[model samples]
Target chain A: MRRAGVLALVVTTLAVAAALDTPAASAAASRLAWLVPVALGAVTLGTRPGALVALLAVSFRAPDILAGVERDGLTAVTFDAAGDAVVLLAAAVMTGSLAAAARLQRRRYEALGAVQRVLAIEAPLERTLRRVIACLDWRLGCAALTLTLRDGDAVATASAGCSALAASGNRDPVTREVLRSGRIVYLADAGGQPRPRRVLGAPLTAAGVTIGALVAERTGELSPPERETLVMLAAHVGLGLENARLAAMNRRAASELDTKIAAATHRLAEADRAKSAIVALASHELRTPLAALLGFSELLATLDFARDEVRRLAGIVRRETARLARLVDDVLDLSRIERGLPVPLGPRRVAVAAALEAAVEIFAGVDADGTGRRFAIECEAALPRVVADPDALDRIVKNLIANAVKYSPPGSPVGITARAVEGAVEVTVADAGRGIAPEARARVFEPYYRAPDVVRGVPGTGLGLAVVKALVEAHGGTITLDSAPGAGTRVTFRLPIAREASSAAPVD
Target chain B: MLAALGALAGAAAVLGGHGLLPPRAAALIAVAAMNAAFIATALAWAGAPGAGAVAAGLVLAASGAAAGHPAGAIAYLALPAWLASLARGGRLVGLGLGARPPAPALLAGAALGVGLIAHLALTVSRTRGYGFALGPPSVVLSSLAYDVGVNVPCAECFLRGALFNRAQRRWSLHGAMALAVALGLARYLADPLLPHASEVLAGAVFYVALLGMGNCWLFWRWGSLVPGTLSGILLFEGYRLLVVS
Candidate 1:
């Protein structure tokens, strides 16, 4: 609006000045006098207006000045006319310069606005690239853009206006120059069969490393200034491209890692199945030998009364062999349970208190001399009968009680408790001794895994807890440990009470 | 005494700002000294050296206002120094005496100086329209001189020192430089096409928005926004001032 007003005022003032300076009014330059007032009016309006008025005034005086020179034969009037021309030219240049400056400023603000939009919203990488490309294209008057980036040796990737352009690979020279010199490259034209008329290439370098080249293509030619501008634009474009690429690479890596972890998990599950099978086979194979060893040891014990000294030696051998047979039996049982092999179990409705007493009776004769451990059973009188495999149940209870007695400190009491809990029998065997560490607690139930805090040289097989855990679970029960280092250890197992006698029996 | 001290500080600030002294250290010291003087002599009236402080303040405010364009206003502020020589009864005459040869010469000289500065700024602004536009011939030359002779190298030092900071994290000098270059380029490409006061103002607002948005993305994905943001600010402003000023 200001420009328009100024231009209007200039044109009007010049028109008025030309009228006053017309040849007819020259003789009456003093008489015509209205031109001065008009000129003053134009100045008040604005410079453009004043200049316009002056221009008109001079144009009007031009003919008179020319006529006077012709008639009077003097160059003074012609010189005066030329002076007016010079003033008008000066005014025109000033207006033109201001207009150009205004245009430049407007461009700058528009660019800022575009950048603002880029920053204001969350956009995908592709969208950002497009926006950046559009911004550069709009400002530089370039038709197409190509950003070629080096990965290791060759161009890692190239973003181009047309995929076909990328296919042609005209950007190699620019890329090579940037890669070699690590400097911006400007080309007036790509001198090839299918060359772009004007090309501006700048190295997209970060940390003094020339990572890529940004090339802007134009149809005609670029001025030196325009070329320089393109190089700068390319540099910025390179940055945007690098950001996008890095984001993409990171995303790709994350996805790849996720897939790898999934594959690893599947392989681990397969390995677990294999281990279970191995344990089952080993246990089944050892059962026969274990039974034979037990029979021989019992037979030898009976024939041990020939002589006092010989008898005592035979008793020692018999005890050691019996212990070895028991160890083998425990391993076979643990392996069978782990592999889900059917065991000969008879289910019957039995009183929970009777079962606890029976397990205690079986362990009463065990050597607890060194430990001085005593066993006690505390069963609620009102505890309901639980239907289970009596032999398996007895073995589970006996194993827990024996372990407690064997491992507890001397003079400590091994407590056995049985109670009715939510339609189930809850039994716990607790021992006062060195406790299991938090790290080893989970592994203690696994075959051959013993708590490190247990004395290194102990008598029992480490499969005790493994067999206990399996037998408990087979009866639709759960076993867990409540123990910490130095606080002693308590192992608890819960078995569901059978609703009917038939429910306790396993189906074929 | 405080008032006198403040006057000295004020003088130092002017010298620092005007490049008569090294800008970085001088700027820091001058700022501290002037602020202290302002507080210490807070109750002092405008008399004796106090007047000089007031004058210095006015100059500073004017120069700061014209920071991006360091011509018109800065030169106008300096013009009075030459006029002081022609003082008559503590006031200089204009029209008759002002139009005298000597006075015109002084005014012409001042105008030329201002015009030259404005021209230089415009040229720089044109050349440096994008991140650190310091890559341009003009900037590279000036930076070289500064690094070799003045040895201040504030920007370079900042970049190098900042690498050691854990809080500054994302340790890519290349990425920083790239961001700088992008913003600078954006400004340059933007300015000529949208050349207008309203447009320039709008552009500035938009540029800031871009920086903020880009930084936010960096922060969200990488958990660090400072590097991207710092580079953007430095490059954008540097480009605007140097190439497009």
Candidate 2:
């Protein structure tokens, strides 16, 4: 581009030199030669270069045009030479002006496209604001820029190539005025002043309401067209900021959805594990009793025997049949518990010692396998009467004693202790039996859960302890188990003490 | 808007030149029509539909009266002296009649008004042939009554009471104040009394804008129109004492 300007300069200078050297008649024709360089420079190089060439042409042509004027007061040749000079200058100016306007229009469209590209994507607010500043600095040639937005009651600021605080903190009075007045404020220092800059501040408005402000500083005069561009850009910037905030909100909602899905997957994995353990324990415990009842009844029906032999076989069949019924009942209760149904209860005040003795007697007789169980019962004197259904409390105690008797060796004493502690009646059943491992302690209350090493040898369903825990909790009480493998297990439960004996109403 | 003002001013000049009316009466009618133009615009902007007819009647009355009977020419002056009666509990009280403005606000307004008058009186321009208008005490007092009673209340009604009240809801305090100042300058532009010289016109703009901005602040700070009206009365009274024509 500079090379074109230099070529224009040489041609324009040569044209003037020719006009000065030629005769008066021919010099007028030569003066028009400068038009060629002006037209070519404007088309190829740009506006300023073409206009500069015009000034140089007119200056070189000046002397010849004036020489005739001093010799002969206003001759026609001088008038003709001057008219040609005017036409040359006018041509240069007109071409340059048109070129300058076209260049400005293209720059404006490019700047708008740059701003729209940053706003089209959903991005963070800080990223969006930084791009806005970068867009103005790169496209508008702003030496410094500051964008301030109102975040609730506070102002949030972004700066490019300038101190954010200086512009936002009233270092530029025009910025404050623009924010307060919602108008464009322009300030240009006089030309003679040192380090002069033009500062422009415009309101950033959304929906005809001002939400923030933008300030731009550059080393030039503020053109009316640039001011208009700022006004339109400010509106786009406000909407861009709103879009960024929405993106942040969407990200948070997505994160919450991911967390919920993870929780549901974990619950499903736990349920699958529980189902596998139930299948293994239930098949063995149910089949053992069924095989015993089937063999004894078949033997009695098929063979003729003495009366005593027949009676003994009949006793074996009745014992196995009863065990089968118990197992079926336990399976039904476990199913109901797994479905999250609350245990039904009927409540009345019952003497704590009396309830324990009755539960003990029920289990003290010969077991279903014709095995006798040794038991011990201990109660603190003056133990408070507890508000409970007599039948539910009896079943709770019976389940715990039964779990201990099943796990204990033959004739091992199962101890039952009852006392009033912390405004409640506490009962504990302990057995000197093969104890539960520490790993299985946490899930002992879970229905149908059994130790992998212990369930194959045990001759009962793994539902006794879980049923006892639920029945205790339904009476507004708590139950805890303490055990270690190869040691012994102790299960304790507490129910709130009754205010008056037998005064509590029945369960709903 | 400028074309509308130019048309009204040009109408009087053409009428006077064609001897359709005596020159002084025509000039008086033209000034009245210019003043009425501002009033008509304000009323119409406020959604009152009858402003144009009222403005026309005012000009017609000014046209019929002779120049020597200045009061007769502006016979509307008779009602201005009592217009203060409507100001105390005005019908427009529904629009931001805030707590009674503190006494200090009135004092500050008077000080500003006095200060503005001091600047105008001390800086009389010789090149523009501008100075204080002189007349008998009766004429001066009558004009002062019009300034205090009619003009102050009317300007306060539209600029601070109507426009500022609505604009502040959508703009910042300074934004609303700036609009009042800009509208005040436009009102001067439509007036025939505004001088044609560029420097005098600039000075008039500076003072009018300053007065308008200050009055907007006064009303916005207290949410009431009384202090601004008081300041306006003082400023225009001062303006009357220092007029060029």
Candidate 3:
């Protein structure tokens, strides 16, 4: 309201001075006239609302001058009043131009803010284009806004806010000129029809390429600066649209990764099922062959072959056949033990001294072979009578002795000792060989596991210790091993005394 | 009706032992002879489905009678149904070995006894008077002293408790009945007519010694007894300690 009052007074003073024909006749008003416009113009120099008020006041004064001439004869007016009218018209033009510039500058700032908000809300290219077209209609006072983007060679309409421009396929001199020159083009007022008053066009350039054209229509005449604001807004919309397109592509790539992971998981489950079936079938097939080997070996041993050579051959056959039986039994026993089945147990009254002697005799024959590992047996005659399964005891002794002989180098003495302690018969088996490393000792009793440094083609199934530990524990005995790398191994087990059967006091 | 109540109480005890019974049902059975009231209603409500369906009508009557209020009846019945449904959907079916029908009767009896005792234990920590014991010496009465100065345990010293089952898998009932008889007879045979009689019973001792020895043998033969063999041994030992010690 203050801007309007200042603008009105300036226009009146300028017009009165301009109506005078001679500069001398209007000189006083003209000098004052300069001050009035300068102050009003300065108040709204960079602001649209203030500049608009100045333009309106200047335009209003022009009408009054024209009305005065029509109402009264031109002869009645002074020469200076006519001269002042000419100067007032000139001043109005300057004020109107300033107001239009400020209005255009303000519109561009508002359009930039609106475009940023749209990009923030919607990230897809097609959606951003749709919003750009809608904002041009609402904010720029355009009757129609059409966007035609180049997708490969063909230029096609991507989105449109106005129905009429979209129906016409958007091909016009203005659009073609902007696309070809990659610059802004404006058509003003369309010869005062008001219906097709103005059209402004600008090329949407992104990454140094002319990608598309943005065209807006105005129902009223547009000044030079109004046309410039439309063109700048068009470029900002193009940049926002490009960012959205790249984001969509990234989302598509992430979806493909999820699909591949699901496929791989399905394949792994199928492989696991196939492996379980193979183990079941193979174990079932081995059973029959093992039974045949044991059957024939028993028959051959009973034959009583005449010559000593024949009998020796029979003994070798029995030994070899027994090895085959052991392999199959180990496989079945490992599976059963892992499945949590209990191992059978037997108890007998055994002389502790005799058991040690028997174990030494068994290992003595094996040590005599080319391996040349020596055997030593130490027994305390006063060792208590142990109630244990003799058959299980023999397996424990044999496994430990055989393991020692197999692992140690020639000339390393394998030691065995027995004693009575804590109302129990305790036996110890020690072997001087490449001892088990600490890291590997924890896994030595796990069926089928072998250390990394062990000979890759070794014969044993790695089930010996597991079986020995199980059998000993079933007879109420505890076994422990002590070993270190290169120091050799010592294993000991203790069997409880037969309390019910023995009434005699401890020999110790 | 009383016989039925007794059977149900036995069933509750078994379930409590295995931890199979729903908490609400266990609590109800633990309240004095609360199951006796339910058995009476079940009998009165049987063959009278039009009165409201046998199970529903009996539950309604029993809950009201046992709890002595309508609101309490709603609580007792509704809580069990809700809790049972929650358990049945997952943990009860997945983890509990005693949920199967064959074990329910045994589990039920044990559950009732243990739950009641446990509830009482929580409230009265020092009293253990209601607990039962079984085993030959603890359950039987006898007089015998060893002239050889060897420790001769009294029959009643070993008695923890007795297990009675009418349905024990088809023909196995005969063997179970015979075992119970032999165990009972051994209790009476502990008293000697003369000093030499103690020495003469050595063969009998050897024969009966097979009982303890055979149990240990089976433990070795079978890797794992589903539901665990240790639980039974602990239950027996606990009873022995309670009475004899």
Instruction: Indicate which candidate wins on TM-score.
Output: 2
DockQ (Cα-based) per candidate? Answer: 0.01, 0.01, 0.00
For model 2, residues A197-268, the per-residue Cα lDDT tens digits are 556788887667677888887653355677677767777787666656666777889989889889989877
True-structure RMSD, every candidate? 26.0, 17.0, 49.9
How closely does chain A match the true chain A in each prediction, as TM-score?
0.46, 0.67, 0.42
Return the interface RMSD of the candidates, in order shown, one decimal each: 26.6, 19.8, 52.9
Q: How far is B134's C-alpha from truth in model 3 (Å)?
A: 99
For residues A1-508, write the lDDT of model 3, one tens digit per residue. 6667566756754664365334354445543454355335544443332333333333333333333444453654534445554454455456655665666677788889987787767444566667767766678776667776776687666444443433456446667787888888766432222023357788888897777888876553354566667777778776766665556666778788888888888766754553454355445435444565566566666766558756666565566566566656666666777889977655777776676678777567645466656678888866667877776777778788877877777778989898888978888889888899898888777655556577343345567788878777777889888999999999898888877555343331
The DockQ score of candidate 2 comes to 0.01
Candidate 3's docking class is: incorrect
Model 2: how large is the Cα RMSD against the reference? 17.0
lDDT of 2: 0.68
Per-prediction backbone clash count: 43, 1, 54
In model 1, the runs with Cα more than 4 Å from the true position are A1-326, A336-347, A368-372, A455-461, A501-508, B1-245
Model 1: fraction of native contacts: 0.00
Residues A335-388, candidate 1, lDDT per residue (tens digit)?
677677965557777676887887676556544365445778888878776767
